[model samples]
Target: MPTAELPSATPPSTAVPAVDLRGVAVRYGPAKAPVTALEGVTLTVAEGEFVVLVGPSGCGKTTLLRVVAGFEHPTDGTAEVLGAVPSPGRGTGLVFQQPRLFPWRTVGGNLAFALARQGLARTERPARIMELLTLVGLPGFERRRTWELSGGQQQRVAIARALAGTPRLLLLDEPFAALDAITRERLQEELRTLADVTGTTVVFVTHSAEEAVLLGSRVLVMAAEPGRVAAELPIGLERGPHTEVAALRATPEFARLRGELNLALTSAAAGTGEEGQLPPAS
Candidate 1:
């Protein structure tokens, strides 16, 4: 059976720069009845920092991501990627829970599509595409159709597609949520290694505290349904195998943080019936 993992409520932080959002606000519909997703949400993530956003499902975490990706405009405040207002096709890469691959295109071709949109030179594009595949551990799977790969492999392709732009910041919204436990854990490890190797700034959204602790340098606890950063939690740990989930989880610090986050979720659920009504899924 499936179970929910818990997290501590309080989080500590350090200053830096992968992404910074100052007073960002999102309202759907009218001004009076507008649904506010995020407000006065100021955060700074340094280069190469792996920050995870954890919260109740409706907290607008995805909306926050859409805003940062320049897919949705913030009704108030600003979202800056590398010191500039983020624009679509800008130096910001996005990975969603679904692979969203183009069925008509081969894996390599899908990547090429992204690079082509950026106007990369023809001569340089192929090699770059190959490198991206290899980086995501999909080497030589290039000519394969998107549907040919397994769920995990398809997500790898998506990551490659996201990196096709060599983005300054990578935004991922529960990309591994839909996978099986084993597969999800494997991808978590793969992403950690990739983060170390590429020094890419990663902003990830996840519901699993274990996943967040395993992959994040810092975890920002959020409340969904008009999502907002309610609290922050720092893993204060290093990256490594989970050989013992029960054992590591037994530590006082880990348990404490987990409980705190769980409480935040409880609070988020209290007022979320309103926010969840806006979209099919908030």
Candidate 2:
């Protein structure tokens, strides 16, 4: 099948992109009967952009994220992050669907662990942990044990831990999928605000079109059989410091955009191998 045509990965400016992938592919098992996980995938995520990958299960969203995180190597083509080849501990942070925290540690301990890896001095860790917690809306909760916190709170601590290393790129794979609707929506808004405040480039994966539309500055819809991008849409919502999620969701423009993304996702799940007929980004 011909690779779907995606929007150009290059940014409007000359600055190097946070992620650059060209003809990237991943396959597994015997050569004769190799199962292709991703094929002819090309993507570029600009610095400070919140890019979301939305697709059904088995569409290689997590696989693509792992490729960028340097946890998995591509079988063909080149992938670069921060203008260089990607590898573990290369100025990137990751959050999985589960809050993979150290069970023995307190929330502060978790952030301290990451800070220590970044070569922070012991004397400075206390202040830094508080600061990081504040950023995630868990101020002064560092002393709480991981098991003592609720699911959303634990994930907030997990996010703080990831931020301790001051990574330029943050990769998240369905981090809020397990939470209740109320908690998930709250975290979604918080995360969007956090991204804006910190200016961190984010590549998030999700199966929900609503979540993608709510949080992403741009969204990419992917197909399943030999997973590849089936569509790309730039979100043009007028978000500001005062913008509320409820108010934003009630707008006609927001509904229209959501409908468009839903249609793209439907086409991708249908396995038609056809690119979405979206208008060119302005």
Q: By lDDT, who's the top model here?
A: 2
Best-matching candidate per TM-score: 2
lDDT of 1 by residue, 78-165 (tens): 7787777778768888898999999999998999999998789888888998899999888999899988899999999999999888
Q: Which segments of candidate 2 are over 4 A away from where they belong?
A: 1-9, 279-282
Give the Å shift of residue 85 in candidate 2.
1.0
1-282, model 2: which lDDT tens digit per residue? 122246454446577899999999999999999999999888899999999999999989999999999988999999999988898779999998999999899898888899999999999999999899999999979888999999999999888888888899999999999999999989999999999999999999998988899999888988888888778877889999758788889998788788878877777788653574443222
Each model's C-alpha lDDT? Answer: 0.75, 0.88
TM-score of each: 0.83, 0.95
* Over 4 Å off, model 1: 1-16, 224-226, 240-260, 267-282
